[model samples]
Target chain A: MRWKCTVAYDGTQFEGWQSQPGGNTIQDFIEARLAVMFERRVVIHGSGRTDSGVHAREQVFHFDADWSHGPDKLIRALRTGYPDSIQVYKAEEVDEDFHARFSVVKKRYTYQFFEGFADPFETRYFWSTGNRRMDVERMNTAGKLLSGKNDFSAFTANPGEERDDDPVKDLSLLRAERIGPRVILAAEADGFLYRMVRSLAGCLFDVGIGKLEPEDVLRIRDSRERKNLVLTAPAEGLFLDRVWY
Target chain B: MRWKCTVAYDGTQFEGWQSQPGGNTIQDFIEARLAVMFERRVVIHGSGRTDSGVHAREQVFHFDADWSHGPDKLIRALRTGYPDSIQVYKAEEVDEDFHARFSVVKKRYTYQFFEGFADPFETRYFWSTGNRRMDVERMNTAGKLLSGKNDFSAFTANPGEERDDDPVKDLSLLRAERIGPRVILAAEADGFLYRMVRSLAGCLFDVGIGKLEPEDVLRIRDSRERKNLVLTAPAEGLFLDRVWY
Candidate 1:
């Protein structure tokens, strides 16, 4: 039977959330850890794949295992053996047909930064902006344009994916707010188009820095051309906050 | 002529903040970057040395360079040249006798934790706590005891260079507050004995988890015995927040 579990991981040491050739992948590592205890090869499926150096607050995954252990014991074992960068925040038993990715309903994300000189101690976890004051209002206005259902082809990175052919996506929410020198981008969506968050952040950053107008979001959205988008926000600023099915 | 610059770095890739013989260190990397620009070797003196996986908000450093560039231009160039992880937040020309460590009056530190369900995104940057809800209020009450001058030998890790007889430290601030599921520890002291913040965090974490009583701080403080301390808080949570000279 399949069991879905909510997990969290540090993405700095990973290539991305998905399996990759040679590079460390969060899924591969988790599967390895589970394999040791369950004595079987388990294919771990995640709600969504994140990029290198990205983080997730709560990620959903599922795997099939036959064991006498209860959910709590499984969680405890995973917690004890999982790499420091990866953790099983919670564990639950699901019906055999439950799928972590296809069943997910919404996802949330947060991006952070440090103003002035970041405490060197916290720099790894946050983007650093020495002293460039930003216009949060403009970024927020532009962010509002990204809300609702729309084609997000302009914001995706890998345009070759067939997702562009059916680019329309339901963006339930997107907001860029400022905290000190840091910016908090809280976004919620039924599901994200590839690189959509990064693309939106890049545009909002442009607006925040006075490089783009809030109205520019409409034009960018209408164009639906990935090449027409601004820069892709650095992977460091993006995070996967949570997933709900 | 000499200049004092406050620096910030992401220590994930380095051995630590201090210069060492073989591994890459923040100090060595900064010196290398400076050498490439000035065509000569330059040594930087930092206010503190943090360990691997540690971060700093504003780390003060001083260097002697017979260069003609202004602090502003030097700052810009240095920032542009350094890796994204290393940033020169601000640069100032200092009096010849200014010392980053000796002249410092107080230093503040913070420890961050993304408690519960290890978030993949915050994994490297925040410590994770699974299966246990954090008792922030208890941690806060215990933290208050550290606000004034006290014998802190029990709260420091390594405690290198400082003799055991020198256990007294004047602390100006200590706090543990909650922001979301995370805790922010704000600590300031005239000067910290080695590993003091991390050591305190370990004990406080135990207190938050109900293992240590809030009043137990007095026992730990009075014991001046390192053997009684719990595990050192993971390096990832520690941040050099600020300095007041």
Candidate 2:
């Protein structure tokens, strides 16, 4: 049976989502636990890979298991086997053809930043603006320019991943919202290139802090060059918030 | 000059707010940083002490320093001097008679519990309810029963501190509010006895889970015995939220 599950994880201690040799990755932990549960090797496919120090609220994945007790037992087994930093909250039997990665309709990500100085209590979750005030309106304006179908080559970073992935993707939402002292940049796209969300957020932060003009986002997008980007933000502030089918 | 500062910290990494020999305490870090700035030893008096694994949103402290750069500069210097988990946000010169400890009129504490299973991203900040559903109304009713002036011997725990402190105290607010999957218990009092907030929260959680009736809190209070209480919630869920002069 193919089971689709929504998992959440704090990626700070893991070497990202993909397993690589001896590195402590989320995939390695999950697969190892599943192996123990089934008494054999089982491959669990995730919707996408998140970089190190990045978090996930509802990362979807699929794994085939022949447990007689079904999805409910599988969820309980997984939850008991996994550590506190990783959990499978929801699981259900899916159509045999359903694929966690290829079946993805859209993915939503959020990057959080705290304006002014960093709060000691919130440092782990939010990227600090370094005591600088952010212009949310300017950030929103810059974010709008990057929405819809566009070649986001400027926002892509080759983090040992092949650069042959398509640069043109549909972004339904790229906007900024401020909640008290924290600024949230929410991005929903058909798919994101390697480090693309961080790159876009970093550029919008530049606009928010007056380092770049709102119109500069368009120029950078048209340039199709990653070297022209100002920043890639940081992985600690990014979250794979949701995956929509 | 006596400077009053409001500090915040993530207590997960420290041995609480009070200094112990060879222990990593918030006071030790702050004093060490201040000594570096002043080229001499500096002692800071915090309003009160928090237990290990407990957080602080705005712990107030006072220290004597005759630096020429003033409070604004002191805040900036302290910000740079402290690690990400500890910070002094606001500092101001205070009258000579002012005391961070004795002058405190009230203190507010918050204990956070996440209902249902633990979320991986929030494990560090919130206590899990072990996948149990909480009755917020019951918790609130129980919390209210613990309010007002009363002898809270039932909620006090001896933690090496002198139990000579008065057990009679006025609790202004002991309310429970549910936000999404998280239930927050906010308690305001003239002063807290050792582990009083955690004890009250734990007892109320018992009420929430139907193990105890709301009226049991009143019974526990009147009993005036520490053995009458249900439990002492973990320190990780407690926060010294604010101090009111």
Candidate 3:
């Protein structure tokens, strides 16, 4: 039987979502727990990778197991002795053909920004923009210009790194909304390149703070090339909100 | 000159609010910073001490320092090299007669509870009551019974510990409000005994979940003695919200 689980993690103390030599990543912890439960090696696959300090609200993963117990017991077993920062909230059995990584339909990411100095509680999840005032309308205007299917090479980090994934993606939504002292940027796409959301967020933030014009963003996107002009927002401000399957 | 400062701390990584031999308390950090700024050691007096894992939103402190720089510059200097979990946000010069511990007129504390299982983001700030259904009206009824001036020995912890402070206090307000899946209990008083807020929270939580009746709480309060029946909620769920002078 195959089990699919929806999980959330604080991500502040993690070394990203992927496995590494140090064994400090979220995947490492979950896999170790699975190993202890099964008394053998078991591998679980995540929908995608998130950088260190990037939080997840509903990250999906799947693994093959032969347990006959129901989902509730499985959830309870998985949550035992786990750190409070990570939670496996939902679990269910899925068909053998279902894939956690390949079955994705769309993904949504949200970036949080504080208008001024963030309070102690918010500093972990938000990026403080100092005392600068952001123009939400201008940010949205620039975000709209970058929406839809396009070659987002300008927003991709480590352009020199070799990868087979295409640069073009259908960005269905790119919008910014302001609530009190917080500015949230939501982005939905069929697929995102490496650090694509962070790059887009950095560009929109620059536009909102009058560092870049809306037309400048268009020019940068149309160039179809990576440059130093586009900055990648810090990982702490990014959150993987949803992954549709 | 005497300066009053309002600070907030995450409290998850510190020993407590007082100066301890380990030098891991919030006061130790602030005094260390002040020592670095001035040539001599400076002592700061907080409104009160909070236990480990107890958060604060506006914990006030006062200290005497001969500094010519303004409050804004002082704030910036004090914030330098400080961990993100602790923040000193507001600082102002006050009369020498003003004291952080003695001049307080009222203090407000908030205890947070989650109806079901709390998510990763909320685990640090809220106590999960499992799947139990809480009766907010019953909790409030019990809370009101415990309010006003009374000798609240039943809600005090460490009864055998030596102390000169009186157990009688004027509890101006005690209310419980439910917001969606979260229940917040706010308490305002002229002063609180050691672990009094947590004890009150635990009793009210028991009443909310039908483990105790409203009249049971009244009996406990009127007992004027500490007992094993009144549980003290964990420190993480309690927040020192405000201190009024």
Candidate 4:
């Protein structure tokens, strides 16, 4: 039997979602607890990877196992065993063929930042940009050009990432908005490359600070060169918001 | 010259608000920075004290100093030198007779807790009370009995605090409300005894859980003894919300 689970976590304490030898990652913790509950080595898979210090509102995962208990008991046991920073919100049975990562049709990510001064209580969740003023309207104008299927080679870390990896992805939405002194940038797509969202956010920040013109976004996308853009934003401000299947 | 400053802090990292021999308090950090800026020893007087792990939204402090720079420059310098968890929001010159603690007319405090499941991001600021259902309406009805001038000996730690310490205080407000899964308890008073708010919150929590009747609160107050109430809520969920002069 396969099970689908919805998870939310504050990623500050974890190395990321993927399991590593250090045993400090979210996957490592979840798998360890599942192994304890099932009385055997149990592996749990995640929908996608998030960088260290990045947060999640609704992340999906799935696992295949046979158990004597129901979903409610499993969720209760998981919540009790896991750390406070990790929350397993929902769990239910799924088809055996279902997969957490491959079955996803769309995913959305949001980045948050603030200007002027950072609030003491909010610094953990937002990127504090010091005293610089940003032109959010210009950033939003540039974001419209990011929509559509395109080879985002310029926005990815390296075009030479594995010979079979695809640089072309279907981007459905890319927009920016200002909520008081806080600025939010959201992007949705069928798939993203290595650090693609952070790379694009860095370019948008340049547009906001008048370092690059709005039309420069279009030119960079057409360039198809990784050197066309620089400055990958920090991971602390990013959040994996949602996934659709 | 005496300068009054409005301060806010996430007290998770500090020993408390007052300076101690260990020099780990909030006042120690502020005074250390002020000493560097003024090129002399400096001391700060706070409106009141908070326990370790307690937060503040608008704490007040006063300091006497003389320097070549103006208030704006001083504020900017202090902000740059202070840690991200501490914020000096407002600073201005005040009359010599004005003192942070003595000139205060009122102070307000708020305690926050959440029922059901806890949000991952809010774990630091709110108390997670798992599976317990609190009657917010009953808690509010019991809260009304806390107002007016009364010897809050039943709600405080003990009457042996000082030679002339007064247990009688004028409380203007004590209210409770529910915002979704979160429950907020706010209290306003001309003064507070040591751990008075936490003790009151504990009794209210008893009433909320049907462990005690609302009339039992009046009985406790009339007893005028610390032995009547003994539970003191944790410091992490307490916040010094505002100070009115």
Clash totals in order: 16, 0, 0, 0
* Cα misplacement distance, residue A133 of candidate 3 (Å): 2.0
C-alpha lDDT (0 to 100) for residue B162 of candidate 4: 65
For model 3 chain A, where is the 10-residue window of minimal lDDT? A157-166
Cα error, residue A207 of model 2, in Å, equals 2.7
How do the residues B1-245 of candidate 2 rate in per-residue lDDT, one tens digit apiece?
89999999989879999998975999999998988988999999999989888999999999988978877888889987667899888899899999999899999999999887657756767888875778999988887778899998889887875657789999999999999999999999999998999999899899999989999888888989888446999888899999998
Best by lDDT: 3
Say what the RMSD of model 3 is.
Answer: 1.6
By summed lDDT, the worst window of 10 consecutive residues in model 4 chain A runs over A157-166
Model 1 per-residue lDDT tens digits across residues A1-245: 77778777767668888887773888878887888887888889899788888887688899888756888888877876557778886888889878998888888987775666555445556766656666888888888877898988787777354543357878887787777677888888887877778788777877888888899889988887867547777777677888877
lDDT of 4 by residue, B1-245 (tens): 99999889999889989887998888999999998888998889999988888899999999998755777887787786667788888898999999999998999999988897667878777877788789998998889987899998888875344635478899999999899999999999998888889898888888998988877899898898877455787887789999999
The deviation in Å at residue A73 for candidate 2 is: 2.7
Q: Which number leads on TM-score?
A: 3
Q: What class would a CAPRI assessor give candidate 1's docking?
A: acceptable
Pairs that clash in candidate 4:
none
- Alpha-carbon runs more than 4 Å astray in model 3: A159-162, B159-161
Off by over 4 Å in 4: A158-164, B20-23, B158-164, B228-230
- A best-first ranking of the candidates according to their DockQ comes to 3, 4, 2, 1
Provide the global lDDT of candidate 1 against the true structure. 0.78
- Chain A TM-scores for all candidates read 0.93, 0.96, 0.97, 0.94
lDDT of all predictions: 0.78, 0.88, 0.92, 0.86
RMSD of 2: 2.6
True-contact fraction in model 4 equals 0.83
Worst 10 residues of 3 chain B by lDDT: B157-166
